[model samples]
Target: MTILLALDDTDSLESRGTGRLARAVADAIAKHYPIWGVTRHQLYVHPSIPYTSHNSCAVIHIDADGGEPLNTALSIAEKTMLDDFVEGSDPGLAGATLDQVAPAVIAFGRDAQQMVLTQERARTLAANLGIWLKGLGGTQDGVIGAMAGLGLAATRNDGRFLQKGTIRSLTGPTPAELLLGAGVDEIMTLDGRRVTEGTIILKEGKAAKACPINGRVVLFVDEQDGKLVAVKRN
Candidate 1:
């Protein structure tokens, strides 16, 4: 089973973003479970939403064969967040097995992309779905995005990878085979051209930013100056 551990609103403007915190949490959990990837889920951006920057949430995808209880993973994530908790940040956390995510949860994620959502609604839906969700601080409004992040990630079609294998350690031009070995499932051009043998050139100092396509980590590239350059498509 695939497990989705989600976090949101864990940082104020003065502190690191939630995506970084999610990576820290993933690193802590990596001691026990195999991390599939860390994904950044974008939420609705509006005047009403009090976000540190782009109003995005983070999720750590895990393979459930680690033999650890769900609470163990949750406790690790919770401790990681609290260890670097920023004052005035409204942090929310949620976890659910891929199979337990219902249609309503996905709809809620879709809705969050276009409209405002409430904590009560998020909490109620999580309870009904048997998803573990909690607020760490402040308004606890993070519960909304935390649950939404899980729902979006459960779809296996939204968000970009904030952490995927050793993709972050690579820079400059890299072989397609190397990227695949580093947890990239497929390497293709933005126009759907699949590449298997050629090198995917990275733009200067940029690292590979992969997106989930059809439940696989797909790295999209575009031909620029006669070289295939990786594109950030979030």
Candidate 2:
């Protein structure tokens, strides 16, 4: 079974980034299940929205068999965020079975990318769809982005991975063999050309991140300075 989890607004300006916090949750859950990865979705950014950074949210995909592990994963994520989130920060977590999500919820996510959404609207939709949604602390405004992220994550075109969710981390100029061995679905340039064997992919430390597209883990790149440099996630 595939589980979808979205977390948002778990920090203040000086606190740890939500992407890092989401990575921690994915790491914890991977101890029991196969975590595909966490994806960072950019939400609508405006003065009306009180966001810590980038006005974004993160969604994680995991392979778990039953509701027990899913609940356990949710507990682990909520506890981690509650214990670890910065003071004065509002945090929210949205989770559901991927196969059971409603299409309307995903439409909301698409709208959120371009327009500001309200908490009342998200909660109403979640209520109708019976999706899992909760606010961890503060004013609980994080629920808005958390809900939107869940919808966006269900789509193939919304976000970038925080990590590859493999036991081995890919850093620096990685070879094609390493990427394939680490469970990467495909290695391709930004223009959709596949990387072949014996090719070197120039990645800059942690900045080099991959995005999920069309049900595949895709690392976009471009030719620069005579080397294939990864297009860092924004």
Candidate 3:
């Protein structure tokens, strides 16, 4: 089962951010189900928005088998946000089974990136889709961005990984298969063209990013130092 667990707010300027808490949720659930790591989606950061800092939300993907229940993960997120979030933070948690997410909810994500969204609209869409939405403290305004984050992430071509598990730095031309084994989904150029799985492409001692592009976590590379070295997408 593929799940998108998104969170927003959940922090103060002087405290730990929501991304940390989102990873904590993924770590806790890893004991039972396999975690695909968490992707960070930058929400609308405008003068009209009241954000602690960078207005980014996170969605951790979990591919579960018949073994563990999904509630186990949601419980971890709820308790962690309630306990670890800074005082006065309005932490919102939104969860969706991607296969079941509606078109409206997905559209909500695109809207959020372009303009300010209301908590009321977010709640209505979550209710219609039967998504799990909750707020921990403060005004609960975070519910808007929380659901929006999940929606945007479901686009499958929107953001970069906020925290992928044990991503080691590359020293030279590692095999493309090796990079895929480390959680990358594709090898591509800046133009989104696929690169063949041969020794010609090397990692070249750079940090690789698993960008969500066309429903895949693609590794983008460019010509650096006369060789194609792996690069990250912003």
Candidate 4:
């Protein structure tokens, strides 16, 4: 069973405190389920880009000081997840908006037997509608319990530890799958080795003309014409 803890903009700007509130809610959900993985994405609103993520059983949306649109976006995400459950596939509705159909989406997820939401998701929706989390079987105490037992603390102010969980690095052909938030341009081969760089490398069955003895190898390309301009050895 999995639960998707999704966040939307409903709480007032002064009270929305995402990181703190998210952590608190995550803590509570850990009591009933074990979170397996987390993936983050960027939501493009008219002028703002908010951060969002999907955990084993929850989805999280974090944004800046925006209100109505945030709520609308959250509703869309919830609906998307529910749609996936219904279809039994990767619901290709990640970036779509469905504000008018939010209530129906919530009801669907609630009825799914294999999925559950963290107290945070339930509480945020309830608060927006002047309802109570307890009425939905979601509560702050549950979140606190999950966080404490799982050792999932709120992210710190310093930009050191942005990722959660023990699996910190990636190993495979598509490194992009691991560093979804990192703006990596491309991956290339240097000295018969594969390395990630800011540009793609093109070769004509010949050794690289200029190779660096230290650091990594990267192929720099022309911005306008998309041509391989230089081979940079860093």
Candidate 5:
């Protein structure tokens, strides 16, 4: 079973991004729970939304078989988030197992990406679904994004991984087997051709992101200079 722990709107204009903070939270949770990866979900970028830069949220995938209670992981995440709370930032935290996310939650997530949503609606839906959700501080608008993140992540086809195993450490050209061993679920070309063995070129100083497609992490690449280079898909 996988637990989706989601966070949103926890940074100010002068502070670090939520993805970095999510990594810190994952570090704390890793003490008790096994972290599968962290994903970044982009929300609606309309003028009505109050966002630091890109309206996005971060979700940490945890394996429930790590032998720790959900509350323990939630406490660790809440404490970590509160400790780094930024002024003027409305932080929200939400979590649930994949099974707990119903169709309503998924609909809410899709709606958030296309239209403006309210904290009250998010809270109501969470309450009905029995999901663990809360607003840590400020306007509490982050609850909307946080709850939506859980739904989006539960779809298993949205967002790109912010961290997955040793993916961040891989640079330059790397073998396909090495990438698969580094927690990449699959490696293929942009046209959906599977790559079983080959060298894939990665950009220097940039963390490689594998997108979730049908519940698997897939690394899509494009051929350049006779070498397979990983494509940057938002």
Candidate 6:
């Protein structure tokens, strides 16, 4: 009955929003089930995202941006098939059915520039976890719902590098991989539409296109192939 809240970073909405939501869900579960512990992890897309842990009976992935956090949350809920209510039972007891209890909450966010979860992948996660679905709505109330959202009420950052041309690409490996290989950099995205050099001030994957700035530096480039790939900054 431990709840793991894996976040990308402390700066993003996943940290603030999903962190709050995890707290709320933990609160509700505490009332009926004995929560073992709640943990959070910052995630990155490079080196490939880690599969939800085996210890996690349920997981929630929240994108740094808006829409996907809710969508991912709902997908996890559905996969876990979390019950809204459980009969008087000790969740800590062996062989205890996780009735109305979400075993884990996998909250996602940004590490460098990579978006970790995808819509199709989220739906697949739900199928794997075996939980019900519910969106984590926007607002304080929605935050509360994200925590409590399992029942029904459950409503539910990083840096720069360089720019080349209209199609600027990192001249190395993927951001995350580059970090492992080299270190870090102050790489920024160049506006293709405006042709202005701008850094990513704010970002969210689901809302990437809608961001005021042009394309973000979610991936690096293969200096050889001239293709976008993951890279470490610096």
| Residue 87 accuracy (lDDT) in model 5 | 87
Q: Rank the models by lDDT, top first.
A: 5, 1, 2, 3, 4, 6
| Model 1 stretches with alpha carbons more than 4 Å out | 65-68
Lowest lDDT block of 10, candidate 5: 65-74
Local error of candidate 6 at residue 16 (angstroms): 4.9
lDDT of 6: 0.26
Error of 3 at 194 (Å): 4.5
Q: For candidate 3, lDDT tens digit of each residue in 1-234? A: 688788986467766887777878878878877887688887888888778777888888888632235677788888877778677788899887887577788788888888988889999888877788998788898898899888888888788876665554544667776776776777787766677665324455535666787766777888666666777565
lDDT (Cα, tens digit) per residue for candidate 2, span 1-234: 789889996579867878889988888888888887788998888888887658889988888754887789899899988878777889999888887578998999999889878889989988988888999988898998899988898986778777774613667787777766776677787777898665555554554467788878877778777787767655
Please provide the root mean square deviation of candidate 2 (C-alpha atoms, Å).
Answer: 1.9
Model 6 TM-score relative to the real fold: 0.26
Badly placed stretches (over 4 Å) of model 5 are 65-68
Estimate, for each residue in 1-234, the C-alpha lDDT of model 1 and write its tens digit.
888899996468876889889999999998988888999999999898888768999999998742355678899998888777788899999988888889999999999999998988998898887889999888888899999998899988998999998999888989888999988999888788998878888766767989998889999999998888898887
Task: List TM-scores for all candidates, in order.
Answer: 0.95, 0.92, 0.84, 0.25, 0.95, 0.26
Model 5: per-residue lDDT, tens digit, 21-44? 899999899888789899999899
Error of 2 at 3 (Å): 0.9
- Lowest-scoring 10 consecutive residues by lDDT in candidate 1? 63-72
Q: Is candidate 2 or candidate 6 better by lDDT?
A: 2
How does model 5 fare in lDDT?
A: 0.89
C-alpha RMSD between model 3 and the true structure: 3.3
- The Cα RMSD of model 6 versus the native structure comes to 17.7
Q: Which residue pairs of candidate 1 clash?
A: none
Compared with the true structure, what per-residue lDDT tens digits does model 6 show for residues 81-192? 2232122210110011123233332231221123534434333334455543233221111111122212111111122222111112223222333332232222333322
lDDT to native, each model: 0.88, 0.81, 0.77, 0.29, 0.89, 0.26
